[model samples]
Each structure stands twice: as structure tokens, then as C-alpha cells.
Target: MKQTQFKLICTLMAAVFTVSQAAAQTKEKQIFLSPPLIRSIYTADPSAHVFNGKIYIYPSHDIDTAVTDNGSGDHFAMRDYHILSLDHINGPVTDHGVALDIKNIPWAGRQLWAPDCAYKNGVYYLYFPVKDKQDVFRIGVATSKDPAGPFKAEPQPIEGSFSIDPAVYTDSDGQSYMYFGGIWGGQLQQWATGKYQPNGSKTDLQNDDAPALSCKVVRLSSDMKQFEGPVKDVIILDESGRPLLGKDHDRRFFEGPWMHKFKDKYYFTYSTGDTHYLAYATSDKPFGPFRYKGIFLKPVQGWTTHHSIVEFKGKWYLFYHDTEISGKTHLRNVKVTPLYHRSDGSIALIDPFKSK
Candidate 1:
């Protein structure tokens, strides 16, 4: 759809949902919308799974801030894991307990981010990011026998250079693949937990094999113990093909690329426009010639969304963090929408909650 037509449709849906929002204002009443799912789980970077008849939400717990109460000192930006489940994703959600935590793992006391889970054989592996004292960030894998479990976490980290926002994908070949790294060069050495040194504390610490690209992905060993190769680079925004996005635009892009295969074709979704909006690209191969799809979503009720997408109950939902309170924390909200594909090959997201 053209931008103008898309705006009109969104505006109409917004008006229809405005009444529902007002009704939801009373504390005794609950809205049919997506979040404040876990009020205590001050959220961001969400990962969802359908296991054992429930939709489990594993999100980055906002455990730290500059202030004493909000800030978890040692684990900077602690992504302490909390669980919330919903019998019917279309309605009321339930809160479970703290499934995993950083303080409990004293050896690597650091902040964790974007915990994602997948069930293989009989084990549920949770993938997330953490920063050690030197501020060097890496992804960690923990296994649980059950979705809601006594998770056994290992002290050893997933060996990779400056890896964070760990996402594991099990390909058709029975090969496990992980995609991570951020706008700021993926392999950059941490000076102190999520904080990077300008000079990159360790030379060649980022990746022994990657040339100069910031983001990388690689095949995982069958056991998911290590990478088969160096962190492979993906989504290098060097040009826009449009002259406006010259060399300058390449440097001014946000990086977070997540992919899923549909009908043998790879659909890669990424964060861009300063992470306020999501755009997509697709390719026949896992690697590129990835043509830009277009904007997936823009500001909602004047809110910016970031880092979220999932397929649950045979439907696709986009989960992102909105800057509801300006400079304050970005509270994570899950917006369940039906993703439609256009004949022209563009992806359109219809906000179901707001439409009716």
C-alpha cells in the first residue's frame, strides 16, 4: 500500500480502538491489548515460544538503572529472565516465576539481554546476552528440561566476538545457526559490561576471521557448543541504491537482522530508521542480494517500536519496545497483528487490536 493510503487506514483503526483504551483506564478493568503483561518485568527485547500448550514470553528484564533501586550494579542492564504465559494469546495472560537470574551465577555477574528459547529433543535452550566486568558482551546458552523449569546455566559463554542479542535458528539441514551483533561493530571488546572502549581494548578480539564488518553470523556445531566458522557478517548497510543514502547513510543505520524461512525463501527482518521502525528484505539464499521490502510499521499513537517479531499459534505477531515515557525506560509491549503479503511483494501489518 502507498504511504498515504496506509496512513488513512491506520488512522481509522486508531479511532476505533480509542474507546477500548478509555475503557481500559479503570484499574478493575483489563484491556484486550498486548501489554503490561508482566508489570514487574520492566521489559525490552522479547522472545516468545509455544511449549506444552502455552505461549511463554521470555523478555529482557530491566533490572538496572543509574539509580540505586532500579539499577542492578554488577549486572549492568541485567536481563534477568521472567516468565509469563497465556492459555489464549487472544486474551488474558498469566505470570509465572523468575525462571533464570544473573545474581545466582556469580562467576559472570553481568547484564543479559534478549533471552530466546527453542526446544530441541527434550531440552529447552535459552539464548541471551551478557556483559562481564570488562564490559565485553557475549551470548550464553542455558538449558531447562521444562519450559518452566529449574534451568541449569553454565558459567562458560558462547565463544564469539562481541556477540549479543543471541538468536538460534535450526535449519532444515538439522544445522543450528545463530545471528547476533549490533550497529556498533559486533566484535568490539567491552571495557566494562555493555560499555566499549574507543580503541577496542583487544585488537582482533572482535573476530579473528571477519574482515571489518560489524555484524556476523555463523553455523553452530551440532551440539551448539561453538561456531563452525568465524562470526559471518550480514546486513552491511553500505548503500541505499538511491543517491540520498550515500556513504553517510550507510554509517547512520541501526542493526538487528532476524530471519525465518517461508516456502524455501528467506525473509529477513531488521531494525532501521534509528530503531523506530522495522523494514524487511528477502533473498532466495541465506546470504544476500536482499532487496529492501519496505517499512513494516511506523510510530503508533506517537510511539516508537523496536526489536520484535514472532509466529505464534500459526499467526505472526510483532513485539517491540515503545518509548512511552520519552527519556525514561522503554516499556516492552507485544502487538499481535496479522501480517499480510502484497502481490507486489511488500509486507503489510494490520493492527488487529486497534482495528476492531
Candidate 2:
């Protein structure tokens, strides 16, 4: 065969190989688990929960990118809360209309990101991070008696550090714990929060009595607030250990810390590698001695993954955004999938070959 034919064959081979690998990764149990793939009703940060026999989704309203909402598409800055109900967790979705419009709340003009909902006592706490350039990115508390309602935002935000992405997890003991900030934190956490000192309890951050859970919970106190114990230093997301994100005393991986307690161990998931793909750490207690688990996911043919984990009702989902070819970083949509966990206890995202 001539050189040109050989080159053509080689080119064809490369394209085929690339396509095959891509198809296989997202197909088989290979790459990692990501979300919906086709985002019809969500954007940026996604907070999904099963409430009243349905999965209600709250997505980020902060349209930081250049894309225009145009009153349509994922670019729209969500001012009001849009509620969607799905009978099955892998949603065939229907928007139940705006459950909570900004006008329904006392504070009516802030952007929302990563809104979290938790049912406690007799009230539903719709915990969300508000986005305002002039305002400190903070978590807001909204409440309603009914799951679907004109949910009202509390006059006061979850006051502590400047924050965002409020993820509330009620422990097996009925302890309601909130995890967020960082990717939710915006610029505040970027340069400082990663430095670490062992023995610091998380409860040292605030004096609020909202529920008693520590804001940091770097070490779990019966109450989640800052620690009650004498820890070495205050809570910080340690990134000096992980080499993938970046290397500097300044660069750290403490963005989103969501944890789940297993038989005898606690699995803590946080974002570090580029504020994309998920990474995790495990500890005997909610506190330190956290062992690093390398990249739970990597950038795939689809979107960049963030704020992800296994959900209740036994299905797993990865929440993230994919940049459109039309525009790079601005337009993001949420995707979900049925996920599987590894026997070794590590999170294995589904590869293209196994996505089916």
C-alpha cells in the first residue's frame, strides 16, 4: 500500500479507536457515574431529594457564564424555585410550577445555587446558597409545612462563614448535618481553607443555635456546629496531600464535604481536582485521620462533574455540568444516572461502554 493509503488507514484507525474507547467508557462500568446526560430542567449545582414519594430538584440560579438565558435554555438565572416531581428517581420529569418564587420570601432578589431540602420535626427546610456579588455567598433557610408550597426563605441566612451549596444529611442517629461551601464558597475558600492542622473540631466556627450541628464538623460533635473538643486547629480542607489538583500551600480541596457512615467507617466526598470530578476521603469518625481516595471521576465526553454522591432509595447519581460546543464554560446542564459501588468501597464511575 502507498504511504497516503497507510496514512488514511492510520487516521481511520485512530478515529475508530477514539470512538470505541469513548463508547465503551460511558457504556461499561468503566469511566465513572455522572448524571442525567440530557438536562431538561436543571443547571449548575443540583440538589436532588425524594420527598413525598417524588424526587424534587433544586438547581443553581447563578448564571456566571457568558451565555444568555433568553428566557429559555439552561442559561436562565433562576430567581424563583422550580419544583419537578418524578415518580421514579431516574426521572421522567414534570415541573410542578414554581414552588417558591422570590416574591414569596422576605429577601427576594438573590440568586440561588445548590438548594438542599431536608424534612425535620414537622417543617421542611429548603437549604440553599444565595449568590450575590456584593453579598457574602451564604446558605439560606426556607421552610414550609407541605413539601410543595410557597416555601419561604428565612429572614436570616445560615450565618457563619461566607458560603454556598448547602447539602444536608441526616445521620442514622437522626442527627441533621449540613455540608457545603467552597465550590459553593467561591473565592474565599480558594486560597486559604485548604491548609490543615489535625485535631481541630469543626464546631468552632459559629455560635448559632439553629440546630446545634457544627458548621465545620471537621470532627463530628454530637451537634454539628464547630467542635466541642480541643482539636489541634480549626477545620480546613487539606489539599497538600493530593497532587492532582495543583501544588501550593494555597491550593486546597475543601469545596464540598458530604459524608455517609458505613458499618464502621465514614465516607467523605469532596471536590478538588479542578472543582470538577469528585474525590473522597474516609475516616473512622466524622473528624480527621481522613485517608485520600484518588479521583472518583475524570472529565469525560460529557460534562465536568461536581457535587455528586449516592442518593437514597438505593440509586446513585452524579451532579454536574457539560459545556456546550457553542460556548465553552458558561452553559451547564445537570445529568443523572443509575450508579453502582465497588466491592473495595471505592466509587467507580460508569465507563462509556457500561453507561447502558
Candidate 3:
């Protein structure tokens, strides 16, 4: 055979080998157990829960990348929330559509951030945050009979809400607790007055023992709208039993407050910005004296890290977000992976991974 013919035959053989290998790999992987659980739209701050025997997620819908500068998408300009669900971990993700939009919110300005949901009696309540007409951050609650709702927001914001990121937990005994708030020392005093006024708490710039930012929790009245008791500060301690504070501090509560009950422990978790990581601390009670264990998820490729922990069937999982799909810093997609706990009940560090 001529040299040209020999070279063509060699090229054809190489192409055949490559095609066969690609087919084999595709057959070996399934999407059910992979990362980036949803793909149709960019989502962030995933709060997963099982309701009526099915898995549902409440996530903030990120603003479109087209309007962003050079499509960098470096700002959180979200104006709505989307609820998603799955029949099983391996099943298809159902887009329940927009549950709530900021435009319909009479008093909201923009920037809808991390939200959560809880089922009480027959009502499904969505707890979320948005900037008021004045740009002050406030938390609010909306209700719908269906888990995936065209939820109706109460005409006014939760009377005393002034911070962001709301997570609701209902105890086994029927008592419901609402956990919310983050950063800024001065807001605590405003929080105490049931309004956002500057006269409330004072920010201490130098105090390491009591950082300006702390997670606050209050008992929710049966209505899920009113505070049942005084708002109390939840003190988070570092690994050495010291207080975590300051922007540069490893244990500082930058934002995102989530609570999960496992066995007999209540886990209080949050994201420490500046060095984004999903860190947690456990306490015997819902409100803590939580002793910081350590970081479960390392810093993600994005600037913020927020998550929700849930147990479905018998396996535990962490649901978070990253910019992998959009390639823009602010427009993120939700992802989840199996989470494991050590013998002592402390969680194991989870490294991020992608699914096929």
C-alpha cells in the first residue's frame, strides 16, 4: 500500500477507538447521584426539605447573565424565588415555576436572597428576605396551601424583621422556631425593638468575644408571623471554645444561618465569607452555646457559600451552589452530594464534585 493510504487507515482506527471509549463511559454514569441537581436556570442558596413524602427545594433565582457587565454577573440582583421538587433522588427535577416574585411584593425593592420553607398544620410557609423600599433588609413569610405555590405574601413584612436568611424548624413536640439574621452589630438593638431603627444595638468594632454578627433565633407564634418570645442571640464558639468574630476571623458568621436536627443534636451552620466555607457547630439544644466543629465544605469557586442539610430515606446530603454552569460569579446553580458524619457525630469535610 502507498504511504498516504496507510496514514488514512491509522487515522480511522484511532477515531473508532475514541468513539468506543466515549460510549462506554456514558453507559457507566447516571445523573441521579450527581452534582448541580438542576440545570434549566441559575439558582442559589438551596434549602431542601421533604414534604408529604417528596423532596422539595426552595432556592433564590439568580438574575440573568445577559444584563451583567461583560457577563461577569458579579452582583446578587435576584428578584424572585423558584421551588423545585423530585419524586426521588434519582428522578427528574420538576420546575414548579415561580412561587414568589419581588414585583408583586408591595414593599420590596430588589435583591431576594436565601430562603427556606416549613410545613405547619396544612399550611406551607415560605420564609424569605428582600430589601424594603428604603433598601433595608427584612425577612418575611408567605403562605400557600400547596408546597409549590403562587404564594401570597402578607401585605406587610414580618413586623420586626431586619436581617436576612430565614430558616424554620419545627420541633418534634409541635413548637416552631424561626432562625434568622446576620452581620452588623447595630442591628441587634433594632431587632430588639421589633423594627429597623438605628437606636437599637450598638456595633462594637473591637470586641472579639462578642462579634457584631451573630445568628438570632426567636419562637414563632402559631401564626408563623409574630414573635412568640424575646429574640435571643446564639453564641457560636470556635473549635477551641473561643468566640468567632471579625471579617478576617475563621469562625465569623458572615451570612447564611441554617439549622438541622439529627438524632439528638441540633446543628447550627453558617457560611464564613472573606474565606467562604460551609461551617457548622452542634449543640444539645436548638439555640446554642454551639461548639464549632470545623468546616464541612471548603471554599467554593464563588464568593458566597450557603447550604441546607437534609436526610431523605436514610442518607444525609448537603445542598449548595457554585458558578460552574454559568461561568459567572453571581449566577450560580444548585448542587448536592452525600454527606457523612464521623463516629462522634461531627461531619466529615466534603469536597466539591461534578456529575456526569
Would you list the C-alpha lDDT of every candidate in the order shown? 0.55, 0.50, 0.75
Give candidate 3 regions above 4 Å deviation.
1-34, 65-74, 184-212, 354-356
Give the TM-score ranking, best first: 3, 1, 2
Cα lDDT tens digits for candidate 3, 175-287: 88888875431133345445566433333233444554677888999988777887878888776776666533566676778888877899998887445678888899887
Kindly indicate the candidate among 2 and 3 with the higher TM-score: 3
Per-model TM-score on C-alpha atoms: 0.72, 0.65, 0.82
Q: Where does the lowest 10-residue lDDT sum fall in candidate 3?
A: 65-74
Worst 10 residues of 1 by lDDT: 243-252
For model 2, residues 6-59, the per-residue Cα lDDT tens digits are 455345434533453354344333433444434454455556676776766665
Model 2: lDDT of residue 143 = 76
Better of 1 and 2 by lDDT: 1
Candidate 2 — which residues are off by over 4 angstroms?
Answer: 1-42, 61-78, 89-91, 103-109, 131-133, 183-185, 190-215, 218-254, 273-275, 300-304, 324-328, 351-356
| Model 1 CA deviation exceeding 4 Å by range | 1-35, 67-76, 184-214, 236-253, 273-275, 300-304, 323-327, 349-356
Q: Which model is ahead, 1 or 2, in terms of TM-score?
A: 1
Evaluate residue 341 in candidate 3 and report its C-alpha lDDT on the 0 to 100 scale: 81
